[model samples]
Target: KILSYLDDSGSGRVDLGMFYAVVAPLCGGHLDKRKRVAFEALLWRPVNEGGSSQITKMDAVKYIKLLRAIYIPSQGMSEMLEVHGEADDDTSSSMVTFNQFLGMYDDSEWGFGIMSTVVKLETRDRNRHGNQVCSVCRYPIIGSRFKEVKTGFSLCNQCYSEGKVPPTFKQQEEYKFREYGSEVEAMKAKCVCFSMQSHKNPIAT
Candidate 1:
């Protein structure tokens, strides 16, 4: 079927030229070193079973099936399908080449990014607890006061507001903390000072 169409040499395997013709359009262009290595690994069947760097029809078909299964919105099959439609009918015919397959997998790495985010969230949750005291300021986390993360440590609201935390603490999350109307005057005062400083010192172009 698809293997016969892509084989080109009538040997039941897709060779280098045939492989390139199939993959080039889908990979968004030529395969780079890393992409080529990944593609070979993915389509490589055991040499003992008549497999090699050159992909057999069966292996190629399986690879294409997996590519079509990639359903991540705006990332996987949807994007690849658009490429497929534009390619020549003889080569693509509902199948992508090794590099194309790898390209689709790489695009799906956003899912992995989300998984990494989950790990970060878990670490945050494990560190968070009710009645936890700020490691830096030694003050209780209470009322409208919240804890801000520092370099492997926590800072109380007052300490954080005073810029006591280090620059490395960039991560923040949506925290449910109470707000105080009394802080409005303090916030307005800080804003006025910032405005005054900005007006006094014009930045050099």
Candidate 2:
């Protein structure tokens, strides 16, 4: 899911700027910091990367669609635009400067909701395990990691995307995989599995 938004060029590789665009919004910081990240991510071209630091109405709409999925799932595109002080009749040719984007947040209630969502997502990303390596590629896993339930086997996002799995599990009829976004979630799954096993084979008291 992270790759879908960041891989704008469809080259199967994400540049550093694109990677930062996706992650910066999910980092712990003041609300303005996250807002700035979101704004830059909408730019036609990142200022430092050789394009003008300007956003068009179309740009805002596209980025807002992505943000709505993450931050305001309850709102429709038109309603989201209204929340951001964008009018449906606004000309697509108009450019929105950074200050104007910031002004919308300062003038609306949507900023509060964005702050809460960022905090929750940031906490989950922070709790992800840095030590877990992919059982297939043997690299340290980051972002979304997939695991097979029966054997504790794991795969990194890239490996899983390519349908790669551990050689030992190759002959299985089907993969019963579970996805984990953070270490806390994986630990909870382990606890649940242990509880189920204990119930199935209770010891004599």
Mark the 10 consecutive residues where model 1 has the least summed lDDT.
Answer: 174-183
Candidate 1 Cα outliers beyond 4 Å, as residue runs:
1-31, 47-51, 71-196, 199-205
lDDT of 1 by residue, 1-205 (tens): 3354444358766644334433432333233543564456544434213453444434443344333333223344443334323434454344446655544535554311232343465455434444556555676543343433122354556765665643444354332333222334335655886999998997888
- The per-candidate count of clashes, in order, stands at 0, 0
1-205: candidate 2 lDDT, tens digit per residue: 5665446458888545445554556676787787788677656244334576767765555454545544565663354444444446673667778887666545455432465665777665645876899999888787988988878798999999999888988998888789998888898988998999999999999
**lDDT for model 2, on a 0 to 1 scale?**
0.68
Clashing pairs in 2: none
RMSD score of candidate 2 (Å): 8.6
Instruction: Note the residue pairs that clash in candidate 1.
Output: none
What would the TM-score be for candidate 1 when compared with the true structure? 0.25
Report how far residue 175 has shifted in candidate 1, in Å. 17
TM-score of each: 0.25, 0.40
